[model samples]
Target: MAERTYDVMILGAGASGMMCAAQLNEKSDLSVVVIEGNEKAAKKLKVSGGGKCNITNVNVSASNYLGDEQLIESIFSQFSKEDLLLWLEHRGLKPVLRKEQYYFCPKSSEEIIEILKAASAKSDYKFGEEIISLSKEEHFVLKTKKRKYKAKNVVIATGGKSFGSLGASEIGLELAASLGHESISFLPALAGFTLQKNAFWMKELSGISFEAEVTVAGKTLYEDMLLTHKGLSGPVVLSASLYWSKGEISINFLPKNNLVDLLHNNRRLLSTALPLPKRFTQAFIVHLGIKDRACVDYKNDERALLVSAFHTYHLAPAGTYGFSKAEVCKGGVKTETLNSWTLESNILENLFFAGEVVDITGELGGYNFQWAFSSGVVAAQHIIENNKV
Candidate 1:
């Protein structure tokens, strides 16, 4: 019933909204407000990188990304690992690199949250406001469950549907539709696959893990393999789910070594290079249908058959855990309607989209968070530059 006022109001206090607020300095001369529907910001952040919060990746590049390829590349080019490292340092947190693959907070994801939260110090926000509608006049009127707040500009920084249990839902996409902005249907990415055919091995080997090379179609990702009660998990399979994964994927239970060579060496000396439990190894050998022929006694065709099994193992996955277990949602705001440099909506002036709400979704690791941060920064700066704030 009463009218509240502000200069800039951002919707969704997830990674992008938080980073967007953080980027607007106290000197911006405009009042900034953030409306969040959740109890706290970045509920997903708390568990990222298994609580360590892989804050960013040192190998961030267009090649490692999916979505609107050109737009993603253009936007990310404006921010680099250096910028993020400096940003973290400014927040008094250091990002540590692990094996040229992932960068993480040395303390924990909670520490990363502390840093980003510190960055939002200058901006004001409503932590429990659930925005229901918006109307733009000379100023924008934002309707939430509790009240109506007016602002000159609004940013849809709510993330995509990933883990609904953690507040990852289709709310952003629905809001975009309400705003007259087009959004792409989203699918779960970075999730493990569950097979239609129950894998007897998975149940038998529920607690087993091994270093493995998993390939789907032709793409390959190498990492540790974990056996779950339902199916397979771990870094390699999760990443593989991004691209090669579909109805089925080919997995090399044994990688980088021919069965012939391994057998040849281990058979005569009775040494073991099969790094799994002896029982599992025996199972593997049995599944390959290789009975006790001495490794050298194998005929050429038998050697070839053994080689194929070790090199190309495959099975169809029934489905995934869907959004609740996904690390990132795959699709979002159709990239064709956005300005890469500014993240401005092509159909609507003074309305902007950022973070996972856009079609640009990144792979597992801190890449998605970094994209959220960079995109938010670009959108806020653009809004400011255009005097929309």
Candidate 2:
């Protein structure tokens, strides 16, 4: 069969690809095609936020992500969180705010996916087509197992390798590398951390969860931290995993109250005096090599030690849960290689990238999805403008 051709060819039918296609379909007359490795569109999106899908966050800024701050700032300036919310509302999909921070679909992820598909109905979708290779001459040529395709412009939105079962791979980074664009290897981000042997006592406290302040890599987060059999997993831990590559993380078990004041002249047992669960406090006390006597019985030095243990419990994580358990992956095609305003490759014209395929990785929230949408719109708008000239 003859190679199929289009004015624009988009890889991956996830958030970025679909959003880009939606913009092109709405604003331009270009013939666009979306090629997806999955059998259907937005497979991973369907499972996001436990199916509701965190579309965006109440608070979004360059500080919430790990990448070139200037690049991120540029993209968001083009399409901010307010712009995204307005767009969704105009399309009859108003996301509801959860926990007063995250914006989630009122019903399910499919609600937003359906809107995107309806908006980009003009674009043809080719599902279950895994791109095998890509090369460029007069136009870009992309080959899959069954056929070949050509396009004047190409958009890479294949995302990162986190959901392997959902067909995630390093193809996006690999393709960029083949085209002479430098990329960083993807690492598991927004995932749980397995503890070192020194923190094995935490494993015994599995299933206990509490609101605490966690500090790592110069970033401090206060959220619920869960002690799991593997080590630690929760909103705060997942966010901390984004900045932490190695070294120690400090957890303040009593973030809201001063341990010294709480223990002041208290007659209760050391474990009982703490605001945390008795079992958890007892285990920690035992791990600290401290007795569980009354708070009044501790010497000044013992009191100081207790205060430090409660306020700055430090531990080094062995590693992350890997891509299988990661909500997203950090690192990809470096932001420096792309036009920040358009997400188009500075090294190669008419080639664009968006979503997790870019080096920017946001903390666990709606930040990642916001970046995907913002970057997609930026790329699409630029493509539309380019076609005019």
Candidate 3:
């Protein structure tokens, strides 16, 4: 029957929410509180990067991101990569770099969650609470099943609408609307695609991965392309998946070697460079009904055409795995409605937004998590500086 009030209440206790709480609580005057739907916070944290928790990335810049790229530049400037490295080091976390510029904790992801909780306990308020409805009076009022809480400042660290199994959703959009705000369209990002019609080759060559370039149109993919039982995956395909509205993606079966060179040099040895899985090699050379003709087997003009085709393999995906498997959602509350530097809502006074809940989405590697941490820090620091309860 008692009303609980705090200086700051953060929804969603995943990466962004936790960072906001720690930053606020570290300050002397603030009483930082986190409301999480899950019985335990950071369930998504444990599953990220296959439980290693890819925390951030190296060599990231505004160009590596999508969405309102211009506006996102200011946000990154506010909380730079150096800021993330400094903050994580302050928390006693040393991350290891993985392939593809990803940075992950050397320990298990559970350790990452524990580190957050430990810092949160220092001065932050963390309640195992789920908010069902939210409203505002002179101050922001949050309603849970059991009680009501008023906060001087409210932060929607609630992540984007994706990965429902891990409790990701668009609840923040509804909450923002309740307070007279508009949100952006939501889409799945960095997820695998399914085909409307089965590609028989997927069954034949399910797990083949090669270190090669994936070019869509004229742009070269910085990541590798992998063949899956369902479809193509890996950084390049996932990156292309973001821009693919509706069409086939182009892929090169061989990256460095020219089909002509393979043919001219030694038709039989072409397989050495691709080092393709036995099954995929069958599809490319044997099952295709080409034998000794190998690379050199074809005449000059004919070899040229085949080499070009190999570099540009077009594919149309059925659809993505949807939110359930997405690493991050593509869209959220549009950037125009919120302050890029502070992530505060222009429509709602004392209201802030950060993390995947906004339209900004990053390429795979640790960029998404880095965005979450940096954006949350900016929002919390801004609230601490600009607002009073």
Best by TM-score: 2
Q: Per-residue alpha-carbon lDDT of model 2 for 239-286, expressed as tens digits?
A: 999999999999999999998898889999978788898999999988
lDDT values for all models: 0.76, 0.93, 0.75
Model 2 misplaced stretches (Cα beyond 4 Å): 1-4
Q: Lowest lDDT 10-mer window, candidate 2?
A: 1-10
TM-score of 1: 0.92
TM-score for each of the candidates = 0.92, 0.98, 0.91
Residue 319 displacement (Å), model 2:
0.5
lDDT of 3 at 376: 82
Model 3, TM vs. native? 0.91
**Per-residue alpha-carbon lDDT of model 3 for 1-389, expressed as tens digits?**
55667888899898989888877766546877788777778888889888898888888786667678776788888888888888778878878888747889898888778877787775444455667888888778888766677888899988987878777778888898887777777888788767655355564676777765655534566567677877777777777666666766677777766655556566454455445555565576553445434444566665665666567656678887777777888777878888767888888877999888878888778888888888888888898897555
Residue pairs clashing in model 3 are 248-315, 263-295, 263-296, 293-297
The stretch of ten residues in a row with the least summed lDDT in candidate 1 is 267-276
* lDDT score at residue 382, model 2, on the 0-100 scale: 93
